[model samples]
Target: MIKFENVYKEYGNGVRALLNINLEIPEGDFVFLVGSSGAGKSSMIKLLIREEEVTRGRILIDDIDITKISKYSVPKLRRNISVVFQDFRLLPKKTVFENISYALEIVGASRKEINRKVDRALELVNLQDKKKAHLDELSGGESQRVAIARAIVNKPPILACDEPTGNLDENTAREIMHSLLKINDAGTTVIMATHAVNIVNELKKHVVTLKDGAIVSNIEKGGYYCELD
Candidate 1:
């Protein structure tokens, strides 16, 4: 579970990015964080990854109070909540398999374990055939799938995406969305921030709309909604 209690975030230049936010995301839930630009979606992603600390209140990931986790434990916390960005963040020089395996290698997993997990991850994204392909050889959607493969290779409990399908066309974007849904179906919590209103309407998952750094609403199995007045 992920919980935010009265969480507030103010930047170094005195710009308030989040205000009195209270949220609770149950385990295995898929959520869409949607709003116009400068709506604090990025700020929430940063806070979740502990890249930015809350000015006040607490953030609990599985009730650990991530706001208070020690420096040495930050990596452990990250492993629990993996993040993916619009940028594929893959090595141009490495094969798809190597890119995903590298994450496990860093954590000192055995080669056999790396192979098994990588295979499974690639399957989850429907890119098993591209394992030996280089980054440049894959299409835009394929690259994103590779990035997703890398993110989930370790089987993390939560995955957060920042504008994941921003660079793709509608068809390609849906492909990316399908990959994410497959991952969510397998029981990992997915919180994605996207500007793709069409995808949001189609998925009809939990939609959390933010505006001016505050959560206006969190609707379950609901399409996009906003206040006009």
Candidate 2:
């Protein structure tokens, strides 16, 4: 389980990005973090991935307090939690297989293991046909699928996505969501931050709404319209 206890985040510029956040996300659950711009959604993601530090309180992943871990252990911690960004941040020149397998390579997995894991990840994202294709050769949705495959190649227990469908059209965005849902079905905890109302309403998943850096509402099977009254 992931737990946030009295979490707070404040920048040096005197901006309070988050205030007294306390949340729990159980294993294999799919959650949507919904909010308007600057609502501290991104700040929460940064804190989860340890890109930023909390000003106060603690964050625990399965009883491990991430807020107090040493800098050297951050990379190891990330192996259990992977992130997919809006930009898709892929190597344009690399083949889909190469891109997804790079994560395993960083940890020095043998070629046999890389191939096995890459194959499984590609299947999970329904991108097996595009394994040999380069990034420029795939459509926007396909590229995002590749990014998802890369994020899950290591079999991380948690996947955090920030504005994953923000760059695609409505149909393409739905396709990307389908892939994400598939990953969630396979038992990975999925936490997504998005502004897509239609998608939120259509899926009717867990929604946590934020306003001015504070959680205003948390609804089971919630829609985008469920913000604080």
Candidate 3:
């Protein structure tokens, strides 16, 4: 379980990105953090990965207070949590399989383990046929799926996506959402921060709406509640 207790975040520039956030997310749950731009969604994601520290309060992941952990332990803590970004940061020259397998290689995974895990990740994203394809050969949706595959190859307990479908058209965006839903169904906690109102409304997943750096509501099977602009 992930719990945010009275969490507050203020940037060095004196911008209060989050204010008194208190949230609980159980294991294997799919949640949509819905909000307009600058609503503190990115701040929460940064805190989750320890890229930024909280100004006040504790963030407990399965009972460990991440805020108090030493800098040396941050890398180990990240093994349990993975993040996917909107840009689909991948190696343009690497094949799909190579991009996904590279994650395990850096950790010294054996060739057999890398092959097995990469195969599973490809299967999860339904891109088995594209394993040998390069970045230039894939569509936007496929590239995002490759990013998703890379994020999940380690089988992290939590997957946080920051505007994952932001770069795709409506149809392609839904395809990306479906791929994410498959990952969620396989028991990984999915926290997707998105502005795709149509997808949010159609999926009817848990919606945690934020406004001005504060949580306005967290509804079960809810749709988008914030204004578009």
For the record, the alpha-carbon RMSD of candidate 1 to the native fold, in angstroms, is: 1.2
TM-score of 3: 0.98
Scored by lDDT, model 1 comes in at 0.92
Identify the superior model by lDDT, candidate 2 or candidate 3: 3
lDDT score for residue 175 of model 3: 85
Model 1, 82-185: lDDT tens per residue? 89999988888999999999999999999999999999999999998898988889999999999999999999999999999999999999999999999999
Worst 10 residues of 1 by lDDT: 220-229
Report residue 69 deviation for candidate 2 (angstroms): 0.1
Question: What is each predicted model's overall lDDT from 0 to 1?
Answer: 0.92, 0.93, 0.94
C-alpha positional error of residue 151 in candidate 1 after TM-score superposition, expressed in Å: 0.3
Runs off by more than 4 Å, candidate 2 = 226-229
lDDT per residue, candidate 2, 134-226, as tens digits? 888999999999999999999999999999999999999988999999999999999999998899988999889998899888888888854
Residue 205 of model 1, lDDT score: 98
Cα TM-score of candidate 2: 0.97
